[model samples]
Target: MATEVLFYHLTSQPLEAVLPGLLMKCLERDWTVVVQCGSRERVEALDAHLWAFSDDSFLPHGTAADDHPEHQPVYLTDGPDNPNGAVIRFLVDRAVPGSIEGYARIVLLFDGQDPEALAEARGHWKSLKAQGAEVTYWQQKPNGGWERKA
Candidate 1:
């Protein structure tokens, strides 16, 4: 099956703030998630952030150091492996997977303020669209909401 690609252009908030909400939505629908970052440091940063992002609640996630990845509802990694059997994957920090297969959906969030991230996201958009994938683009509105642009 073809993977649906979603481009989330972040202009108002950082990934640390936006990620958990999306992950929560996925969990609400009973969909597991794999969050892929570009480096180990980013993975660690996100790991820490996710744990403390909210004071009211927390998302259930794990990393390689946590062990037993197969049991985690959300898996954070710098690599491409989906140990948690997640049907959906979120790519951040300019991380690109080796293959888009084995995923029902792929969400790519980029910093609208960073030129590098913006360029990389556009590249992925063009590449994936040319390959006949269903791609959509969404930009953040002023109130921290999303509006589909494509």
Candidate 2:
């Protein structure tokens, strides 16, 4: 089975601003999510952001170090382990998973302002395409919305 890969180019907003909404969408679909980031610092920062991203909103999530990983609707980790049994996986800040096929959907969010991040995303896109994955590229619009470019 080919995995559906989505590349989100972040320009108008930071990951903290956009991630909660995306995770919320997944939750709406009743799909558990695993968010993998580049470093422990990034993971911790995201965990904090998800809790305080909005005054009126809150995303129930926890780090790998937190207790009861299987109970978390959204799991955050620096490694590529899926203890939460998530069907959707989010790769942000250059965190590459060991295999994309295991997940139903894979979202790669990269910072557009960083040349290194852009190049890495491009490489991942080409690799996944070559591997016969269904891939889509979404560019962030000026209004902080996403537009599918490819």
lDDT of 2 at 47: 88
Model 1 whole-model lDDT (C-alpha atoms): 0.92
Tens digit per residue, CA lDDT, model 1, 1-150: 678999999999998889999999999999999999999999999999888888899889999999799999999999989999999999999898557777889999999999988988988999988876789999999889999999
Candidate 1 displacement at residue 129 in angstroms: 1.5
Tell me the deviation in Å of residue 63 in model 2.
1.3
RMSD of every prediction: 0.9, 0.9
Q: List TM-scores for all candidates, in order.
A: 0.96, 0.97
Query: Per-residue lDDT tens digits of candidate 2, residues 1-150?
Result: 889999999999998889999999999999999999999999999988898889898999988779999999999999988888998999998997568867889999999999999999999999988888899999999999999999
Mark the regions of model 2 whose C-alpha exceeds 4 Å error after superposition: none
Q: List the residue pairs that clash in candidate 1.
A: none
lDDT agreement with native, every candidate: 0.92, 0.92
